[model samples]
Target: MPSALVFFTELSDAPSKAQRELLTLAASIGEPTVAVASEVPEAAVTQLGAYGVNKLLVAPANESSFLDHSLSALEAAVKESAAQVVVVANDNFSREVAARIAVRVDGSIVTDAIDISADLVVTKDELAGSYSAQAQASGGVLFVTLKPNSIEDTPQAQAVSVSVEELAVSAATAPSVRIMATEEKVASDRPKLTEARVVVAGGRGVNGDFSAVEALADALGGAVGASRAATDAGWISHDAQIGQTGVTVSPQLFISAGISGAIQQKAGMQTSKCIIAINKDVDAPVFEIADFGIVGDLDKVLPQAAEEIRRRQA
Candidate 1:
């Protein structure tokens, strides 16, 4: 096995838990080398070595107005390395980038992989983590994007000089699409919804009231999420939506409040380590997968739960 290229957006600093997990997966198939479009800081080198990365392939951040420059650089790195396996974090931008690289190299690509073997067999979750699907690439390179938090970051201490290599790449003539403008989202102190270990989510049973949901989430010191029905009703923003059309979250402990737990909703959060569902309807679909089910109206149950959580802290 040759070196495995781990594509990333940010590596000027330490690798995120997701990126570290990518390295862990890469190490299983081959020597894990980081491929980034950003300048690598000396401090980041030390961090990369902790995760068994001996080499870094960095393409200077693109200056052109075009968005394909970064993708082009990643594709070139994959070609230059000629690694049979490429690993990236499963996200919108990274998946798109991986797809392009797969096409350029005529490789087989798999996304949302939960586990991968050294032989390049990939294990993926389908139907919202309900069913398991495994695939083996017979020829060419194998590109894989792993779901966040699918694996824990375990550091492997190794001795080596960090060698940063310049990866040469030619940008494509024109991008298929371009962004006219960008809006910066307001920053928050809450943990990002996808990365949080604990998450509290609400659904249609709340009936447009997120007061209890937000309060309970705050009390638990976790991120808040909403079902598609809650978002469709305009109770919360689309970014907070947790379902098939929204983001997939695998938190350690997921508390689903007022959510009906349909197959669509389960697709987003079925991988949670433990689930507790609070709903007035015992017959609701949510109870099917709940580790603990509470039969009560969320309006009353949530406030009491929040109060109890706050009291424990006090």
Candidate 2:
């Protein structure tokens, strides 16, 4: 059978949902092996092994270690495992790491692949999720970064003896970029905007009242998002903004309230499995692409939707 490799972030007691998605994708493609540049927890090791990881390569870790510093260790793991395909999450960190690895391995690269077949063909969005195209590896090894929600992260643990090795990193392999400081974001119980299965976004129609957006998001167990206009108007943080200049998302469901659905905004979330737009303007651009469009007052529409969702769950 072909072998697949996955890279993971070293965070928490277990792999994050994004990392688990990589693991699941790897297992589906071939024999799965995982590489991490941090101290591996026994629980994490056990969990990954149970999820069909045949080997786990742990790179030496430091307080400020970054992905660039781990490239040498990762190169060694890829060579040793002889993996044909490598998988990672669709994020900036992974993209940088993949770019470096592609050069080192003389490999073909693809990012934000929405689907990958067992034959190694890749399918991803193009023209800002307006079209989908198929691609194949032309050289070296196959490397792919997957968008969140492209695969389910359910673990398929089996009783297997997974070989765990600690990779050595020589000082010569130090990264070019040195981190002077690190600032962590404030922790939140809510799902990450990019990774959430459902996202509820607000725009100028909210008139600075994000209460409806927050409540609807809370009811749906999703993350809150915002349009560039909303963020520029200071109704929400810029990080929550969804547009060409902000984070791109591919959630199972996206609810847009008051957003105009300009090309910039559509670039960020046009790939969502289901799109519902609520705008008072009958000819709002957002309604053109929405799977369901409602012409009404958003404050009233959102509250009612949230109530019904909660009542159904209850």
Candidate 3:
């Protein structure tokens, strides 16, 4: 069997859902090995073994930026393992690293792949989920960036023992840039926007208040999202924006409140398994694609829905 390499910029105490998915997919393809820039926490190492990762490669701590270190580690791992298949998370930074790796290794790179078969055929959705496409690298190493939430992580029946390896990051691979300072973001209990199974989004209809949208999202234990209009209006941070120009999400459930359901926004989240739209306008475009629709003011509708959900839970 070929050797498959999975690369991550950081490893938390426990492997994240996306990380587990990547490991599982790599195991399915071949002998699964993981390369991370930071030291792997003991919990993460054990969980990686559960996902069938037998080899763990750690890059030496360096003064370079996280991205630079990640690039050096991944490049070294690919060469050391002669990995025929490399998997990465589909994010801006990872995509940049994947692109560089492709250029350096003379490999073909594919992004946003939802599935990869044992034979290395990659499957992905195209044209806003209106079409599905399968792609195969003609030859050489195949580098793929998988979309989050696209695959389910299933642990091995029994855990495999992990062998740790230290990677030597050459000076040439390290960039001249260095980090100056860093500040931690305000912590929130909500799940990440991309990885959340449920999302509640607000738009212009919320006027300037997100209390109702947030209440519903909190009640459902989901992440909060906002349309471009709301973000542009300073109602929420750009990080919460969900649309073509922002984050793309494919959650199991997506609720849109006060959003117009423009094509740009649809392009980001149309792949969601279920969508519910709430708006006062009877002919809103969001209603066109929503599995369920409510033609009522979101201010009143959202709070009521939230209360009902909380009540049922209790």
Candidate 4:
């Protein structure tokens, strides 16, 4: 039977969506083996068991403390376990790790996969979201990076004992990059856009102001997002921008305020479960696909809506 290998990053909490999807896909194929570079808490281990992971592989720490060493260790683990399919999250670090693993294993990599079917077929969008493509892994090990919220959240009942093992790392051929001081930003109360269930976004329609959008998001218990126009105008942080050139978000609910709904922006959020648009122009492209459309000034409409939502919650 073919085995699936799932690689997880070291974080404070379990990756909810990635974990769920990997477990589901693993169960679909065969037994699932989870691999971690750092220590995972017991609670997280139990959660992984509930999701159907049969084994957990841990990598040893290195003197360099670089992810390249971690990637090498994971590649070795994959080869030792003879896993035919490897699933990783589509993040900056994971992207690099996936590339390194592919080169080490002489495998083919598929990035930003939205779905997986039997026969190891993966779907992804391309050409600035103008088209979709599907490919199958025919030879060698398959490396896949999944897009957030692309897979359904289905937890299974199969639980297994978690076993941890350290992977052996090889000596580097060249000197590794030196790291200096690292500063970690304090986390905010708002949900992370990539993990949020609901995202409220603003654009140039707000006239270079994001206060209303932020207030609305707070009222709805969601994250604040922005269009390229708003980010270019300095109305919001670039990290909050959603478009082809920015972060891709597929939330349960997406609300766009004063956004014209350009194709670039839609490419980032077209897969949302529900879309609501509040634009002064009824003919704005955003309203075409909006489940709920409000033709008015967001400045006036958002305040009322936010107060109403807060009142109901209170």
Largest lDDT belongs to which candidate?
Answer: 3
Candidate 1 Cα outliers beyond 4 Å, as residue runs:
63-66, 158-160, 219-221, 310-314
**lDDT assessment of candidate 1:** 0.84
Error of 1 at 127 (Å): 2.0
Candidate 4 displacement at residue 217 in angstroms: 1.6
88-178, model 1: which lDDT tens digit per residue? 8888888888888788788889998988887778999887777889999877888899987777777775645667898887756776656
Better of 1 and 2 by TM-score: 2
Instruction: Please state every model's RMSD to the true fold in angstroms.
Output: 2.2, 1.6, 1.4, 2.2
Residue-wise C-alpha lDDT for candidate 4, range 1-314, written one tens digit per residue = 67888887663356565567767776676678888777677778777777777777767555455666667767877876788888888787887898788877899899987776666888887764457899997788988888776777676755777665666656466636544556788888998897688899999999987888999999988999999999998878899999889998878899999999999999888878799999999799998878999999999999999999999998
Worst 10 residues of 4 by lDDT: 171-180
Q: Model 1 clash tally?
A: 1
Pairs of residues clashing in candidate 1: 128-267
Comparison by TM-score, 2 against 3, better one: 3
lDDT of each: 0.84, 0.86, 0.90, 0.81
Give TM-scores for every candidate, taking all chains together and pairing residue i with residue i: 0.91, 0.95, 0.96, 0.91
Error of model 3, residue 181, in angstroms: 1.5
Query: What C-alpha lDDT does candidate 3 achieve relative to the native structure?
Result: 0.90
Residue-level lDDT tens digits of model 2 in 166-283:
7775554455667789899898888999999999999999999999999999999999999999999998999999989999998999999999899999999999999999999999
